[model samples]
Target: MENNMNGQTAIVTGAAGGIGSAVVTKFIESGVNVVAVDLYQQALDVLIEEVGTSGGEIVPLAGDVTDPLLAIRAVELSRSKFGGLDILVNNAGMGSDMVPLWEIDLETWRRDIEVNLTSQFMMLKAVIPGMIEQGYGRIVNTASAAGMEGHALSSPYAAAKGGVIAMTKAVGKELATKGVLVNAIAPALIGSGMLDQPWFDEKTKKQLLERIPMGRVGEPTEVAEMITFLASPSLSFSTGAVFDLSGGRATY
Candidate 1:
């Protein structure tokens, strides 16, 4: 299928991780230049080296997503390097420790909210003005099934992802007539760094997998494909919608 994404520029947060890198690679293959953002310089360097040979241009930025300035810088970098920003992938996020809500520390809860929810807000704040001025844009925020159907022992992550879903809906409606489409993806148990954390032990993984009627975990590449579609002109007429990647687990 023709993605109609050639020569466009995008900023993808969490660009060094499994799902993020997959999205980056998919974007490049579709002829899109990218401004990739992540927390570790070394990981970003490795990502650039790997995807640099793909097809489209890619520049890497290492910074904390929680820092609002990083969002501004990323938007600026996309314009300065690639002429204009056409897409924004709010993908940078982390999972919280597997613990009861009462057992979670206040700082941990705040961190979870900061990384998963506030960071997306910052990116939207920075990128929306340019997109509005140009009268065109595509935004794909990464949400989670945990948000839709709250997860036990993971309240903070659930709450933050839920916020992402709500925010995407609100923004999508606000830009529906401006030729800028905003949507979100709610993925469950994707094979990524977020799952590789120490908290996701065998028992947790097994339990999550069993919840899926498909009886398996999702691949990062699968997620990349869906995200690429959402970020393309081919997806016209859809905004504030949430696509599911839950291996048949999402009933809504």
Candidate 2:
């Protein structure tokens, strides 16, 4: 097995969720020390137990990713536990309320942006300096196909993810000469637990499924595979780009 991350440290936010947990597992499988941050302590405990059984080193930190202080704490925790950080996976995000645009409240919109966009920016701000000093880093921001192409009843989420995509490109270029690569992954209709939320009613779920050309949702592990590749040292060139996982639903 190729150990691309034999001595590296990676921080994965939302590590308790399906997609985030998959990414954490992949990183650990690749020999990377992992700092898994999430808001749920119970879920984190389960993740820790599972990773431990595999002889993997994973430090779980329970906190809300949208909290500005949590990002700083995560970076500090990674440095303290693993000695340093090499990769940051901004996977902490939430879907918007399945309400129409007119029915969406300002607070809900703001919260969506805060969770899906601002949190990533804060994480990047906290991690980039260390990467710059070391002259090596891989930052993978999770965007969405809804961001690339708008989804009905998900305007705020789409907007936030769209901002994430744009921010990734701008930051990638800013650090292009510094050997710190930044990229965004746009996934659509992945069979993650996020779909189990109350916002996803039967009608909404049907609407979502109909949009996918493959007529099925993707697996979290499949998405994790792509993320692992992007976060690995093998990705040398290719920053400020978006990789699609939309099941051919992406017209662009």
Q: Report the number of the highest-lDDT candidate.
A: 1
Candidate 1 lDDT over 1-252, as tens digits, reads: 598898999999999999999999999998999999999999988988888666789999999999879998998899899899999999999986799998999999999999999999999999999999999999999999998999999999999999999999999999999999999999999988877789889999999999999998999999999999999999999999999999999977
RMSD of each: 0.8, 1.3
Clashing pairs in 1: none
Q: Which portions of model 1 miss their true places by more than 4 Å?
A: none
Compared with the true structure, what per-residue lDDT tens digits does model 2 show for residues 64-95? Answer: 88888998999999999989999999999998
Q: Quote each prediction's TM-score.
A: 0.98, 0.96
